[model samples]
Target: MKPVEIAKGVYDVGVIDWNIRDFHGYSTHLGTSYNAFLIVDEKIALIDTVKKGFAEQLLRNISTIIDPGKIDMVISNHTEMDHSGSLPYIMDKIGIQKPLYCSKMGEKNLSRHFSSDLNYQVLKEGDEISLGSKTLTFIETRMLHWPDSMFTYLKEDKILFSSDAFGQHYAGHEEFDDVVGNKIMFHAQKYYANILLLYAPLILKLVEKITKAGLEFNIICPDHGVLWRNPGRIIEAYAKWSKQEDCADKAVIVYDTMWDSTHQMALAVADGLHENGIDVRPMKLRDWDRSDIMTEVLDAKAVIIGSPTLNNGIFPTIADFITYMKGLKPKNKIGAAFGSFGWSGESVKIIEQNLGEMNFDLPVSGLKIPFVPDNNGLEKCREFGSQLAKAIKG
Candidate 1:
């Protein structure tokens, strides 16, 4: 992508990856962008860089506006390879002597990725740097996802160069929020569910810190996806998501079946939830990706998982989903387990145990069938669903 001016003299000189399907195991079906910004002032500064393999594309984009060598300083917002993978190459090409500004942890992290002798200028929160008409203020966002993350604010322009706070893994041509409209929010939700859900508490604290500091922005330029031209839109969205309290009056039934018995049980449970006036989504493991399922779990008040026993243990796919979900640490959820077993009925007990470990409100003892569930067994599953719905309502 060529350099596009975001504001008066600021340009978004970033590279778009239109074919990347997987990002460190998180499915990026919509691809993504490694965004960097360039400011033209008395002292020109480049904020962030693209991934390592796309260094040429980044440099080409920069060339469209001005020679990259003329850039007086470089800012490292996050040391993640996707954002800072081209740091060494850019620094080498544009005089390694130029100062690279970053947070204290960024200095340590980047030095490990590149040569240790490169120029590194560390700045703390509230530090300011002047570039003629525009001034940049630093805000340290420790563990907003990474320890090295920080945001740069253009005081005069009222723009916040947020590193990764409100980013989405969407590779759309539209660079502004209003142009993309509501569709951008779905991508943002998926991004938050898959990437930032585990850090919800830290995100809440960061949002409160920024608000208390009285920082205002006309635009929020993140290191990925589109810029938030409607500044308050994403901030409001993040604030809601970080609280983890605004869940839909819905339930997600996630399961995998060996012989369709578990699938039938899942459907029965869905019927019960529907009867209770709760929105229900039944996802067979084969038909849904784990990341997509996790996104569904984000706004769901309850998660009901079913699995057929295999090798005297839960289905591998269900095991994988449980591991992934547990790591994400979703809170304020009610959970229940149901499944069919040929001999030992251990899967339901195992699921219930895991959910209890995660601190979910478990109201039922879980339902288990010895073989293909009979009509009576299915009714029991429905009753289990009704119990979960009641818990959600309460």
Candidate 2:
């Protein structure tokens, strides 16, 4: 894949990461792209940079269209090494005299990560820069997943150059809607749930600002994944994601069963969900990867998390899962609880309490079973599933 012609003067000089395995801390199960854009005008600009290993390929790709020394401005949207890992190398090849632009926080972060001397010109919210006929506007979107992140707007073309806001880890030959079917939607939602769920508050604020600013963006050139020429799809998807809504019209049941009684209950719950025309994906906590569960949770309208009692508390693995989720603070998931306990039923209560602390700001109803899932216990589990489905429907 060579450089993609995104617009008349704007080109996608981004690198396709088909072989790369990991991203940030999450497993890039399907691989991801480190998208960088090149805009040529009276002065040339490069938005974002590829991963460290891809610096040579990135530079070669740029040379195919224009000279590397001609790049007058380089935009660093986020200081995270994935988006800026190749900055130092690229700057060395392209010369250091060019002006580098980023937010103040981004500047501080970049200095901390690389060398202190590599400071950049700081741009704040509503700042604008000109490149011949087209003007670029900066919107401060701090914590839209990162503290120093910001998006650049192409004023003349109505194209929003988003760094990672609308990115996906999906790598494929397809570029737009006509290429793939609904797989794009699935991959996009998975990326949002695992990556952007924690920054939902800031996401809502950013969307509102974009709307209030009255910017007519005909295209969204994100740093990764496919470009959105049908602006409505990405915008509507962002609106729904900002609100924390799932798309599968399904439910997810995740449980860690010690004996096998709890596992049976989880399957029963899945059955209830299926009978009601709701698709269900059940996973044993020990057998399933957190990232996979996270992807399912992203699209699930309902979620059921459970664990068997262990030594007066919840299962240690489940406790770890809850702790991981606590920092993540995934939103827009309506959930329920189910677990089996011996003499004391502490596991169910513990799971629910942990989820509450994680700030799971969604409708919830909990259920707890005894030491085993007898006829009555299974019935109660089915009832919990029904109630959860009802909550999701509302």
Candidate 3:
């Protein structure tokens, strides 16, 4: 993709990562883009840079509008490799002495990431810089996802160069919200669920702070995916997601079966959840990506997990999913565990313990079946599911 002029004299000179499928364990099935912006003024500034190996492409994109050497300074919104990997090459090309502006933490982080000798200028909250006619204000959004993350607001354009707050792992032809239509929200939601769900409390506080500050944005340019031309939609979504409310009557049944016994139990549980007018999604861990399961878990009021016991422990896949889910810290959930076992049945108990650790409301005791669940055992599974529905409704 060529450089897209998002606003007058401001261009999105980022490189598209069309083949990336996994982003630090988060599934990027639709691929993703490493978005970098170039603001051309009397003093040109480049905000962020693409991933490693894409530095030449990033420079090529910049060269389309202006020479890379003409860029007077570089802004590091985030220190993550995906956003700052090209900094060394870029700084060397532009000029070793060119200023590299970033937040205080960003300054520290960049030093750890690369050479400490680079011209580092630390910007704090409410710091402003002049790019000739355009004015850029900085907002310190520490731990929004990373300690070094920050937002650069172009006051003249009403555009917020958000580092990763409202980003999606999507690399498509559509570059703007209005052009991508409503489907972009899925990727955004998935991104939020898998990457930012653990920071719900911080996100809520950040949104409130931004609201009180009366910060209005005409466009939100994230470090990945499409730029939000309809900024209100993404903001509203962030507000809703950050709350982590279980307003939707949905349940996700995630399971991994060894001998099809746990799979049978999962279906019976889904039947019970469905009978009570609840939307049910039965996902096999082996078939569905952990990231996708998390997306379903985002709005679901209940998360029912089933796994067959192996060597007196939970299935490996089950354990993997649990670890992944635990780190994300999903909130406001009713959790239930069920499984089949031939000898010592520890899977259900292990899952319950994990759920308890996550603060999930375990409304019903775990259901465990011996070897294969008989007709009566399956009925118990349905009953267990029905009880979960009642608890969710209550």
Tens digits of per-residue lDDT, candidate 1, 1-394, equal 7789988889999989999999987889999999999999989999999899999999998898889899999999999999999999999888899999999999999999899978999999999999999999999988878899999999988999998889999998899989998989988888899889999988888888989988888999988899998888888888788787968889999999988899999999999998998999999988898998988899999999999888878999999999999999999999999999999988998999999999998987788998898899899888888888888888
The lowest-lDDT stretch of 10 consecutive residues in candidate 1 is 237-246
Tens digits of per-residue lDDT for model 3 on 1-394? 9999999999999989889888988888889999999999999999999899999999999988998999999999999999998899999999989999999999999999899989999999999999899999999998989999999999999999999999999999888989999999999999999989889898889888999999889999999999999998998898888888845999999999999999999999999999998899999999999999999999889999999999999999999999999999988899999999998999999999999999999999999999888999999999988999999898
lDDT of 2 by residue, 1-394 (tens): 6888777898888888897666655667778788899999998999999889999999999999999988998999988888899999888788776778999889988888776555389999989999998889898888877789899999888888888888778777666543666677777777787788778778887778778878887778777787777777877787877676556678888788888988988988877777667888988878876766777776577667888888889887787667666666766566677888778878877777766766553465567777778998898777767666766677
Which is superior by lDDT, 1 or 2?
Answer: 1
Instruction: Indicate which candidate wins on TM-score.
Output: 3
lDDT of 2 at 385: 70
Model 2 quality (TM-score): 0.90
List candidate 1 segments past 4 Å from native.
none
Clashing pairs in 1: none
Ranked by lDDT, top first: 3, 1, 2
TM-score of each: 0.98, 0.90, 0.98
Better of 1 and 2 by TM-score: 1
Ranking by TM-score: 3, 1, 2
Report the Cα lDDT for candidate 3: 0.93
Q: Model 1: how far is 39 from its true place, Å?
A: 0.5
Please give the range of 10 consecutive residues that has the lowest summed lDDT in model 3. Answer: 238-247
